[model samples]
Target: MEDQTPTRKNNSYCKRKIVTVLTATLTDVAQQTRAAAQDLAGLSTDLKNQALESIAQALEAATPKILEANAKDCQRAQESGLATALYARLKLDATKLAGAIAGVRSVASLTDPVGSIQLHRELDTGLELKRVSCPLGVLGVIFEARPDAVMQISALAIKSGNGVLLKGGQEAIHSCQALVEAIQTGLAASTVAPEAVALLTSREETLELLNLDQYVNLIIPRGSNSFVRFVQENTRIPVLGHAEGICHLYIDQQANIAQSVDVAVDSKIQYPAACNALETLLVHKDIASDYLPKAVKALQNQGVELRGDAAVRDVIEMDSATDTDWATEYSDLVLSIKVVDGLEDAIAHINTYGSGHTDAIMTTDDQAAATFCSRVDAAGVFHNCSTRFADGFRYGFGAEVGISTQRMPPRGPVGLEGLVTYKYLLQGQGHIVATYAGEDAQSFTHRDL
Candidate 1:
């Protein structure tokens, strides 16, 4: 028993053990997920309802643990000299924890979209065509320090009958780990495969997960512009998210002056650090002399730094903003102001420099509002409301995985409905395709849904 093994041999044995463990984990996860997918596809409405109820219960019960883990993340972030805005994002108190739980319950309440037939048609005598909603298999989500996003995405993925692999920021590792534990426990209780919901434990593991394209179907990155860009360029998987939110608020010449001022102030100062918060303010030149100074003064009173163009500076004494200012997404208590010639200039400026995220136009004229709403290349175009309303929750979507600005199917807040995709099913009884290949083939009628 006292015989000593060589150090090199012992090291090799340890490495082998780790490799064996990782291999076994992945294998088991794959098997469980495959089983889960099959079961989900065959799930009755009753079983799905029961699973959702169990998930809601689990989220509610895990509140205390969630709060404790969030406290640790907040303390660490504060000690590590993280930016105040970032720290706020990482911190989650009781209210946010409750809201997260509510979000899970909200997903449970939404109608199950899986198996819902979107379209149906007949190709030939014995062939029938149908298009039904189905899960996207496995979704890999890489996100920053927002612990609640984990719960929201997990609920949506499960409700949509898809597997999820989450890679959260290291800053909120403890919180994310705790949340994952709760989710797994819920899955076990509901007889759902726990492996269907996996969380990466380390940054290196995240990189490895990103490369697991064979296992992952879609990649959704929700974080800073740099992080999103890095994921997009590094991975071949299709990404479903946006890089930035350079939202703008424009005040037209025909705008109600009082409403314009209120909307501008509220949009910029209500929650300056959020993506939907206004970063730039464009005012019509005809009314700039009367409105620019007033708006600047109101923002300054709220501690917002007003950086303006030459015309704006002439109206109000503020920092001279450069061309770069128009393109910046200063997620802070700062704003860029530019005075435009008219509606055309305003539209041109937003389309050229905006992030295609969210923009608003304040105008009293019906045609002006219609033109602004139709022309702006943004996910959301508001008429009189503040840009801050560009949120899934605010738009009545229960919860959102992220706000997408891509010119694709999901161009706005991605909620439970966004997690599902469509598949076409063709049922034929001894119908040969060769019969339809001739020049005098029977014409197929295409009916609209």
Candidate 2:
């Protein structure tokens, strides 16, 4: 306790200097990524595919190192009392790593999303207008505890002709560094520049990354509701991502009891840590007595904790669910159950409490399924299926950067199609605007070529 004032002041000054240096470094990296992305936007599909293949091979070669780094991260997270769901996402085993690599190769095989013509029209003689697809330039992707995203995003960015600046959560820093290193190594061996993908490991870098609107074309955040909301509030760049995963599954009276039970269980327990995992169960009142018991038994056998409303509790014994349960995204093996009078009531409950992520209806009745699929205001509305199926890879897009619950064009699992924007390319043989604005202008033909 001997006069610590000078030491504290010196430490504060050093911290300020370190932060300034980190900020400068982040800006430099953003500039490099921006320049690389401009070049990437014009690469041929063949060259892009070659780069993806090389990246896949590089990931395969670095499996051991990546796995070791992930293990270190998992251990550190556990010691620091990280959340169970995040810990689950942080632990990257061999199978997961291998699958991630395979996904990179799959992306290479899919059709390139760049330069596809969406429209071809002739405004007049020798005047042509073409709308062509193009990359969205540089993407700033900030995610938590999913190191394998490095591989997926890298592959997609290269294939779609965009650069990416990845900012992974602190818990997975080691894993992310290892993955990005391998990806850059792979890029160095191919036509693509290694700078096309960059990683920001420090927590302070996130705010700096968000401020780089001039360089980053879009920001995609993946994490908890509060974290995503924070990014959205603080960033000037357009953000594309969901804040919560309060998804639900409704079992209609016409649903096959066995099939409904299986789908319900799978949706909840298959991968509870995922954003599309079922958080609530809205069972039709008529089928509650018959379906709830079986569903509850199956879920309980798999170590799932059940919470029930009054009607649900009357059918099966479980913990009582409070009003807050309906809106919660329990990214764990815990589910809330509610009993509804019919299909309409179930839909109402989902629309009221759901997170607009993915909601499903289990029913054999075509009309009921149709109604639910049409009316549910979620990114994905499934009929008689597990919510887990709402994924980019499952939909044959190879892999996803993230799932978007926004009410725009990319309003689901965002894959290659979601990563691109379109540009209108017009060609003219010395055509002038005055030609179309004159009093004696000739009647020009507006025709599709």
**Best of the candidates, TM-score:** 2
lDDT tens digits by residue: candidate 2, 247-362: 99998888899999999999999999999999999988888888888999999999999999999999889999999999898889999999999988888898899889999998
The alpha-carbon lDDT assigned to residue 285 of candidate 1 equals 92
Q: Lowest-lDDT window of 10 residues in candidate 1? A: 10-19
> Which residue pairs clash in candidate 2?
none
RMSD of each: 6.5, 5.1
Worst 10 residues of 2 by lDDT: 1-10
- The local lDDT score (0 to 100) that residue 136 gets in candidate 2 is 97
Tell me the spans in candidate 2 whose CA falls farther than 4 Å from its real position: 1-24
lDDT of 1 at 151: 85
lDDT of 1 by residue, 184-300 (tens): 777778757676677765555545555667777788887777777767777777889776889999999999998899999999989787889999999999999999878877889
